[model samples]
Target: MIEKELPLFPLNLVAYPGEELNLHIFEPRYRQLITECVNNNTTFGVPSYVLSKIEYGTEVRIVKLEKTYDDGRMDVRTVGMGIFKVLDFVSPWPGKLYAGGTVEMIKADHDGDVVLQEELFKLANDLFEWLGMEGLVKFDQKMLTYAIAHKIGLSKEQEYELLKTTSEKKRQEFLINYLKLTIPIVKQMEQAKDRIRQNGHFKHLDALDF
Candidate 1:
């Protein structure tokens, strides 16, 4: 297990690799954390904040610092580097107002089976059309999972499961199953709405030949 010390930023959302997340740094502790990371050109870990505890998170690099307020607050942009598991948590590191911990990096399968990739792409494309989203998205191993994750209506728990998954093949299988289950339900809801719309409508009758 590889271990490294990293600053921790806890949030209510899951950050996937290759995805962009915007943050507003107003809290004094977090402001200090961000300042240190920016000045030293270091990266931080964002753990999934759930039920008042940190469970899973990804390492992110600050790509842009949009603004800095008069009171030391900041607006910044970060992109997910990859996922990591916290090995140890430190509430207050020495000489700092923030928290940090040691984490182990998770390996991801970059070149999963090509056949599985094509199958998942088809399912994602079909689901997108069902929801009337314009334009199809391109899929590859690195981004295929994250790109369609939220779009496929997976709950936070499900998304976390995907995050914890280390292999691309397993992630693709999970996505395929989620899509297959959800698409039918969505179609049924549309049919129900159609039925309600046709209720109480007047119908024209043609004369019958005697």
Candidate 2:
């Protein structure tokens, strides 16, 4: 039932909660939008861009305004706050330079299946090892999905699908299946690379002592 008017920034990427997204602001409309947000201490929304339309988005608040260029462009550091679904869209809100929309907040569940989380963690670690990644980022029930979203190699559409899912358990299951399918394929690729690297190597010969 959470509804509010949020400034919408449509992009081809998905922002997950507890994740930091750095953005470059150049367009005049968005520059105005960012400036207003900074002045009013308000947050904005980045609706998921899919096939020339926006349906879902994450509400984000600027953590810091990193830089302001001479041409009025800027770089900002922002963090995602929550998932939202756009209920209505308005381009150029009245006299404003930016687009906005009424969005309904999608509640995320915290109580996911513990056993499933543990299993997924193991699979993720294994996949990381296969990919030659050192060390692991600790994951908890609260931010598990966001922490692993990028690590699982999900496509933009798949990540958006993950963002749309409201239930924690359902998201966990979805990621687990994705990892299950991807891990073996990555493993095969790694093995093939190893074989190619050994292509012209000499083998030790055993003496025939018959």
Candidate 3:
């Protein structure tokens, strides 16, 4: 439904659709890439570089070009439009300094199971509350994965796994499993931290009822 050969920006992190990532364009190739996208009002592909290969990426558009330095570098803000799978890589992009690639946009299902959505929020809120980030997630549209993907603790490979999965229910299941596994450990860590903080405090010990 969009351009097939989009400019490629391979980075160490994963880019999820509907998320905003601000980037500094210091490299010559990327500067050209950002400039061209701004001029054409086009979208580019941000394939995550994992294990030294490019497979999956997110399609993003330059919504705003915040600044252009005197030296020609730029600071631009981009929002991910959708996910994509690279079909082919074009190094130097046939007259471009940066890489370009043929990619097919992968559709993300926004609808999630209501029960699962609730559970995801419950668990997410627990983690956030413990971390003092209680209001971080706004869950709606049944897109619980989108709401929690970036915020929840997930490695780059784990994030890419989410991108590979197109089903909403499955993604929710994956996240649920993740949270169920993670919350206990986080709870233990928090408990240990509290104990550490209370190390020197004098406590009024009530008679222990065993």
Candidate 4:
């Protein structure tokens, strides 16, 4: 297994590859961590602190440093590079105040069968319409799963499962199954909402012949 040492930033949410995330850094240890990354043009690992553990995560790169407060807080923009599995965790890495660890990078397959992708896109389009979102889905094929994973209704655990998935076809199948189960419910709820909207409207009644 290929492994490397990285700075660890554990958060309560999952970060998927190709998704841009903005963060507000307030803690002292994290502040130091970000400072080092900015100064050295380095990368960090964002392990999701969910399922009561920190094992899987995405490797992240600092895209931009938006702001730095007078007291050391920072606003930074980051993008997920890829996924990684934590192998060893160190509370304080020798001299640093932040955590560090050895992580094995997870290889990802972003391309799936073309037919399967088209099917997924069709369902995704219908889902967007039901939720009142406009525009056709035209994301890069390689990054499709990560791009839309957040927009659909997924719990933290579900998102983590998607992150753990390494095969494109498997991920596509996973999303397709979720959409298949969810679309009908969303459609029914929308219909119910429309019926509720007609509560105050008047209707013409047909006259019965005597």
lDDT of each residue in 1-210, candidate 1, tens digit only: 567889998888788998888999999999999988999999999998754678679999999999999988899999999888988888887778888989898877655667877888888877777777738555444456766676677888888888888887788899989888988887788778888998899867798999
Write model 2 residue lDDT over 1-210, tens digit each, in one string.
799999888998999988899999999999999999999999999998964678999999999999999999999999999999999999988788899989999998757888888888888888888998838655554457777887668999899899989888898899999989999999999999998998899978799999
TM-score-sorted candidate list, best first: 2, 4, 3, 1
Q: Which ten residues in a row have the lowest lDDT in candidate 2?
A: 134-143
Model 4, span 93-196: residue lDDT tens: 77999999999999998878788788887888889899887575554444577787887888899999999999988988999899999999999999999989
Question: How far off is residue 36 in model 1, in Å?
Answer: 0.7
Best by lDDT: 4
TM-score of each prediction: 0.89, 0.93, 0.91, 0.92
Error of 3 at 153 (Å): 1.8
Best by TM-score: 2
- Write one digit per residue (lDDT tens) for candidate 3, span 1-210: 454889999998888888889999899999989888888888898998975888888988988999989998898999988888889998989999999989988777877788888898788888888777776666554455865798889887888898888888899999989999998999899999999999999989899899
Better of 2 and 3 by TM-score: 2
**Consecutive 10-residue window with the lowest summed lDDT within model 3:** 135-144
